[model samples]
Target: MLWWRQDDDERETDDEVEVRGRSVLVLISHYFPLLEVLDLSYPLHCYHGAVELSHLKKLRKVNFSGHSDINDKSLLHLFKSCKVLEEAIMLHCFDITFDGIAKALRERPTLRSLSFSKTNGPVKVRYESAYTTSHFISSLSLKCLASLDLLSSNISDELLSSIATERLPLTRLVLQYCIGIVQVLGICCNIRHLNLSKCSMVKLEMNFEVPKLEVLNLSYTNVDDEALYMISKSCCGLLKLSLENCNDFTKKGVNHVVENCTQLRKISLDGCHKVHANIVSSMVSSRPSLRQITAPPTRTGAFSARKVKYFLRQGCLVC
Candidate 1:
């Protein structure tokens, strides 16, 4: 009940297209100037020549993941061409070094989001300064960035701190499995959604606060009950909290969240074995604003799923 098409005419290059194992991207970019999204994350060698992609003025999103042949020069050139680009997803792109990123960020001030997962290639050092060296990363400033996602990368705390210091209007930040980003920069007060799942080495004090945070995801992190309590007290308007696999949460922490975070809508307690199931149930029952709680599908927990369903069906449910 399916079919295949290999011809260029048969391919749908109007909106978005997946080009793999080929070299026609050079010509395709010239044709699709109005394309809003492009996925070049295939295991292919594309754009062999120094093609000028400036023709794509309307491009908004681009994915260059898994393109092993693209060196830093090619990547930089591509990013420079797409000035209207908003989101860029680069995964497994081993050719992009730190200096290459610095160059792109300096040029594209309008970029809203940059997602780089497992893309830290050979360090093409531009200078011999240390990472902690002041102003080493100041040149790489994105003024309009609203979100940043770096998964499984070698992002340093200095790098994050520098970006936060830029006072970029960032609202959402996701750093899943990124090492060396232990201390969250405090100047990121405008952040609304933050996901730091699977970053195990991150330790925190009670000083960090995000006033505008609405959603938080810390699954599999090293944060304890004190961290959660601080966040609940600081981010009072938090709507969603994902504490899955947190090994330190107890009944007291859960009660604080229920009593203080009056706007919380969803909470995930999957694999938080330290937390009592009855406390979770009580929190849900007390917080009428809560919509859902994610737990293990097979865990024989004390919190009855049927009881939660009944509460949600009742008139006490809040949107």
Candidate 2:
């Protein structure tokens, strides 16, 4: 095959060609059939549903994030074609619709990690109704689907609640910048890590127990002292808690968490202007389980600086 067809004038300089467009895809599908990983992100030209990856049976991971040409037809093609497809990261793929995503999931239910951040929203959604939407999204009873990230999308509470109720084996859920999510009442018993940062109105409360939760991030959210209490009562196995930039909670709420979460190891309170330095010092002294602390900006005296060093020497990171 002609890898690089440089003209006579440019023969002296071997300018590396940018591997993009449908030609490169055709070559990979035909020649490199045994390729296990495929990344067709930010392509210079649109594939326009002209490629096939069915021959690449060993394909495990693929990234099509930020590819403008990725529409429903192309997405469905990939999922239906690749039998052993495990993980697909399609972040910022704007043309993807709810209908397309639902169909894709059905085709390749073995997907362990899937991301659809910054995709099409309600105003631009095409050929989808509430009934059809539920029919597909609820079909997310996929066996191996473990991690689901829907950042900066327009997913509503009802739909999100459905995913919660489906009882998928989700271990990590990142819903950062999803403004539609205000509450998740479903007990995320299997979730080991959860991030709800920048989701301003999210309240941390669930009906059932959260026995297996290990990490929780509520940064820049409207989570109040009451929310902290709810978490402390529920997620007793929580290992890390991040409340960065949150001002609604004071020492009262923090005390509940530090006291109740016996396994709590790491806590980040950076940009929390309300958390007094004294409270932090108290936590350092009292909470012996803490291994790392991201404290808010504080005016440190010589004695306090020495104490911080002392804590560091004692196998804990305080910064």
- At residue 180, candidate 2 shows an lDDT of 54
Top candidate on lDDT is 2
Q: Please write out the lDDT profile of model 1 over residues 1-319, one tens digit for every residue.
A: 1111245455445233343323355455666668788775653234343234567778888777766556668767767888888888787665666667777767787889887654442232222244532343567567888988766666566676687677878898887776665677364889898888877567654375566889888888877768778877888889998888888767677778888899988888777877756554476568888877775323463445676667667523321
Residue 153's lDDT within candidate 2 is 61
Candidate 2's residue-wise lDDT over 187-236, tens digit each?
Answer: 34588988888774676556557878898889998877888888988888
lDDT of 1 at 231: 76
Off-target runs (Cα >4 Å) in candidate 2 are 1-20, 43-50, 119-136, 185-187, 299-304
